[model samples]
Target: MALSHASLSLISMIFLAGSIVMLFFVILSGVTSTSPLSQTYFLRADTHGISGARAISQWTYFRICGDGNTDCSASYADPPVGYAWDGNPNNAPAELAGGHGGDTTSSSYFFMWRFGWVFYLIGLFFEVLTFGSGFLALCSRLGSAVSGLLSLISLVFLTVGVSLMTATFVKMRNAFVADGRDASVGTYAFGFSWGAWTALLISTILFCIGRHSNKADVPSSGRRWGRRSRSTRSHRSYEGRRVKEEYP
Candidate 1:
């Protein structure tokens, strides 16, 4: 039982390590400024030129970035103008003959389209708690029950966060159509965010197993047997005394 418990603890830690790695990867993707899910564009108006890109997720929104040297340049949107562009109305630039079909000023939208950021951060907090508890259990500094409880809580938060993010993406896709653009699966891909969710889910399950195994390791059966044996002996002794007194 002890060995089994130890093995479970070890596996739990491994799952946690993997989750941490995925989370770090998501961070790296963001820091590199190369969105795991977004699009870039090149605009030209007469002699003027501009470069632009946008990336978005349920939990967060990277603002549309544009760089151009001329004010009268034309903004040639990507083929079909998939998700991520603003849907608000705007005047066409001199470069494009028709009206412009670009994203609204990113500043007009909140940092995160909805409360995706809030849920994501909250989920992160629970993940940290799970990590801490798992480490403590692995080191024998904390009991398995505590670690398991924390992991369960973390799982709930992660689930909610992941769901919210997915909804955000769907919302953005719908907005694309609303804004007179074509939205396709190709345009709205589930990138590193999905990977992160997968990792967290596995970690949560492992922690649950570790918690159950820990409870099994305690010597409860032996204690229960001992108590029963003692009670039987006491009852026998009492009967023997009563018989001796009656016979004598």
Candidate 2:
């Protein structure tokens, strides 16, 4: 079935909008990773015991990754409470302290900001893919190219992208479970993973839609109506043409 040019454009715009929003949230998660409270909230929400080197009155706090003596990394801890971070495997990383179960590692915060970039980059790529495929199919008139590439991009990215995000969500959940913060929080966090799932589904739809040409007319009730149109017009003109006379 054919999609109107307007419909194709609308679908692309919707996909772009959704991708941008997802990218934005992913970036926000990264920026806020700088704060201990935000870090703790997510960690706890995922099920990890949140603690820090010393209790600070604030909701968030930052500390160096290893001994202040010498380490290239920094860490954020939350609940603004008692715990310590030493790179030492023996001092018991916050992830292991009290045999705590929640987040996989106090270590993850060290890399959490990267997730934002990952999301933004992937989202941007998918948006570009949608727009490019659409342009090839609609504007460039390379409809076949859209069909061929759209399937590949959609299948690979939609599946792999969702998988990566799901893995991260699961790791977070395990962390929370280990720490014993509150299972209810992880329930809400489920939306994070579900959102990715939704994005994948929408992408699949758009990708499939792009693979076909807009010029292909859909079978509609109007087909019979259109069939009658030519006949009726010709019948009315039939006698008129037959009556034509030559001028002297």
Candidate 3:
């Protein structure tokens, strides 16, 4: 019932690959789009029918008659266009308006968002280490003890990083609520990015199981073969002793 090192290595590699893919989704959903950390609302406009505000952490944008009469749905983009961010609340605000440190109202949310990325980057480093360890395990190039140790360390880093990202999700949700936006409705709710987190968590668990597999003799065949060899040696020794006794 022992798991083979080869199998463990294979599984580890799969999990590591999945982790990397999930990290990409996390980045795309978080950095590229405005889900899990952004919200939009309607504001009264003097010149237009309504001004729109989309706030993600400290980055806020106002749009003059962008989507007031329409469905109020807008696309997310880098240096998001078609939005005013003058902070007027009644009119569109200036474009690209906000400090990197986040505004005073939602500074903590921004901090958490940035902090989560830091954790992810650190975790990526550990994941790379795990990749090397898994490769060594597969090739029998390293001792079992060393490979297992490295895997354990990598798992710890990955877990911490993913956990921090979970915290970011929570903070973002809270920020949505603080702005009087209903997080339960529409895109304000958790989306594909959240699903990525779930996938990441499952991958972590799989990696742990795979790492444990490496600690054993593997496939049970090796153990059986060893026992068979020992038994054969014992039988030969017995026969030799009997022949000597009879001859004497």
Relative to the true structure, how large is the alpha-carbon lDDT of every model?
A: 0.47, 0.41, 0.45
Taking all chains together, each candidate's TM-score versus the true structure is 0.55, 0.48, 0.50
Measured by lDDT, the strongest candidate is 1
Q: Best to worst by lDDT, what's the order? A: 1, 3, 2
* lDDT for residue 125 in candidate 1, whole number 0-100: 74
Error of 2 at 175 (Å): 4.7
Candidate 1, residue 2: the lDDT equals: 49
| Per-residue lDDT of model 1, residues 173-208, tens digit only | 555455444433222224445666776666666655
Q: Give per-residue CA lDDT, model 3, range 1-248, as digits (tens).
A: 76665665566567566666655543433222343323322222222321345332222122122222222333332222223332323422222223432221234434554455455566666656666666666655343345555555655655565555456445444544555543322132233334434544454454455545544545577989999999999999999999999999
**By TM-score, is 2 or 3 better?**
3
Clashing pairs in 1: 45-74, 86-103, 86-104, 92-100
Q: Write down the lDDT that model 3 would get.
A: 0.45
Off by over 4 Å in 2: 30-42, 45-84, 89-124, 132-155, 168-172, 179-193, 214-248
